[model samples]
Target: MSLLRIVFKSLRQHLLSTCITAFSIALAAGLLMSVWVVREQSRRSFTQMDSGFDAVVGIRSSQLQLVMNAIFHLENSPGNIEVEDYEKIKAEPGVALAVPIALGDNFKGYRIVGTIPEMFTHNEYAPGKKYKTAEGRLFDPELREAVVGSFVAQKLNLKVGDEFEPYHGLDFDEDHAHDETYVIVGVLEPSNTPADRLIWIPVEGLQFMSGHREESHEELSAVLVKFRSPLAGKTLQMKYNQPDGHLTMAWPIGAIVAQLFDKISWFDRILEMLAYLVAVVATGSILASIYNSMNERRREIAIMRALGARRSTIFSSVVLESASIAAIGVVVGFSIYLLITTTAAQFIRAQTGMVIDPMEFHNVMLFGPIGIVLAAALAGVIPAMKAYNTDVAQNLVPVS
Candidate 1:
């Protein structure tokens, strides 16, 4: 019989243990690949995030908080800037566009942002990519009409002409819903940005919503600013980012978002270490499974030796068996990776409107599986050496 046939026979004899060990290896490989892909893609996506504006002007607070609140629709506003402050920022030198946004309410947990019609009509969220509606038209600036983003519409099953009331605050509360009813006039096309998860209304609609305190009506959450030139941004950054200034301006939005990942880098490192530890444990399981089976296989090894199989042949078979199991695990691991990444992508899209492309090829995908196979093969060396040192004469003697 061929050496591969011999290896197959041995594997079949220990099929249950083989399958279990291979499954452990698959889990390890899948987890490692998933972590690396998420880490790299998240860093890339966040560091390059764009939100139609060059800078955000708000009440003096953390720049990261301001960007997250204004651009990403996350967290509470630092505090409101005055209407006069908004107008002043708009009139500043080099300011090409300044749209005031008021944020305070949500519809079924989806944020309801209030901004001018000019935001969708004039600005490009991405270069050459203006916000377009898949259905109906932009909300009228003077009316209580809304333009829902594609993601929010899909999740809420909202359509044009459908009227809904806004709930007070970012968190949903059925009892605290405003008496004001707003009609959905448009549904925005999916832009794969944070805007896709927002519900947009006229700035007055949010600021003057029924039950809102009168003081809140005169306040603005932040002003989204677009500058005509880079020098203009640097000039204004110095103007607003002063200790005596009441308003904070966050320029270069991407770097502000990138700081978030930098602050939480330690948590990322923890996850990476856990993944490596799991992989090590899984590799050790492969060694233990094969090593513990060696005692039972010694008589078989002796017989194969008696049948003229070379010692080197027995050794190579053990190593090949280990490699073959790992190879099978690598194949199965891809399925696990697909399942995890697909679920993660959906959750991320729902929460942040960012698409994570699992199909995108990364170097880790190429090397991760190969490294596991090699490690498994190396783990087989001790057992292969045992097979190599088998004494045929002693084991071949008949037992009483």
Candidate 2:
């Protein structure tokens, strides 16, 4: 029999342990790749996230909080800025565009934001990518008409011409539903941005929605600003961030978002360390499994030697078996990675409207599996050496 056939026979003899070891390898490799891919992809996507605007001017508050609230639709508005503040920011010398948004209600748990029609008519959420309606027309700024985001429309079974009462505040409440029934005039196309989860109405609708205090009139949540040049951001940031300034500006929006990842960077490092530790433990398991099986296979090794199998051949077979096991695990590990990453992608999309493609190839996918297989093969060296040094005469004795 060839050395490969002998290796296969030995593996078949200890199939259960071999399978268990391979499974451990699968878990380790899958976790390692998943952590790496998710971290890299998330960092890349979030750092590049944009709200079609370069900065947000809002009441003095945390820059991160303002960006999250205005751009990501996360966190509560820190406070409200006056309409005069919005006009002043819009008329700033270097300001290219400014759109104010008012937020206070929800329709079926989806936030209903109030903004002017100019946001859709004039602004590009990204370079040359203007918002387009999939269904009807943009909401009339003077009427109680709303434009629903694609994700919101899909999740809530909403369609153009459907009318619904706005619920007071961000959270949905049955008793606090406003008397005003806003018609959904349009459903926006999927922009793959945070806007896809919102229900947008005229700015006046949200500010004056029933049950809202009259004193809060003319107060804007934030003014989304786009500057003409980088220099403009510096000029504006210094102006708005002054100690005497009533409004704060979050300039270079990407930097504000990146700070979130920076703060949580230690957590990612911890996860990566745990993944590496799992990989080390998995490699050790391969070593232990093969080494512990050595005594039982000694007689077999002796018989192979008697059959004229070279010591080198026996050694090579042992090492190859370890490598083969790892190879199989690496194949299965990719399947596990697909499963994990797909679920993660779904959850992330549901929460943030950001799409993460699991099949998107990364360099780690190539190097990570190769590294695991090599480590596993190295793990078999001790057992392979023991097989090579087997005493032929002593182990070839007849067994009862």
What are the root-mean-square deviations of the candidates from the true structure over C-alphas?
Answer: 1.7, 1.7
Weakest lDDT window of 10 consecutive positions for candidate 2:
1-10
Q: After superposition, how far is residue 298 of candidate 1 from its true place, in Å?
A: 1.0
| RMSD (CA, angstroms), candidate 1 | 1.7
Per-candidate count of clashing residue pairs (backbone under 3 Å): 0, 0
User: Which one is best on lDDT?
Assistant: 1
Q: Which pairs clash inside model 1?
A: none
**Residue 303 error for model 1, in Å?**
2.1
48-162 in candidate 2: lDDT tens per residue? Answer: 8876899999999999898888888878999999998998988999999999999888887888899998899889987889889999999988999999999999999999999
TM per prediction:
0.96, 0.96
lDDT against the true structure, per candidate, is 0.89, 0.89
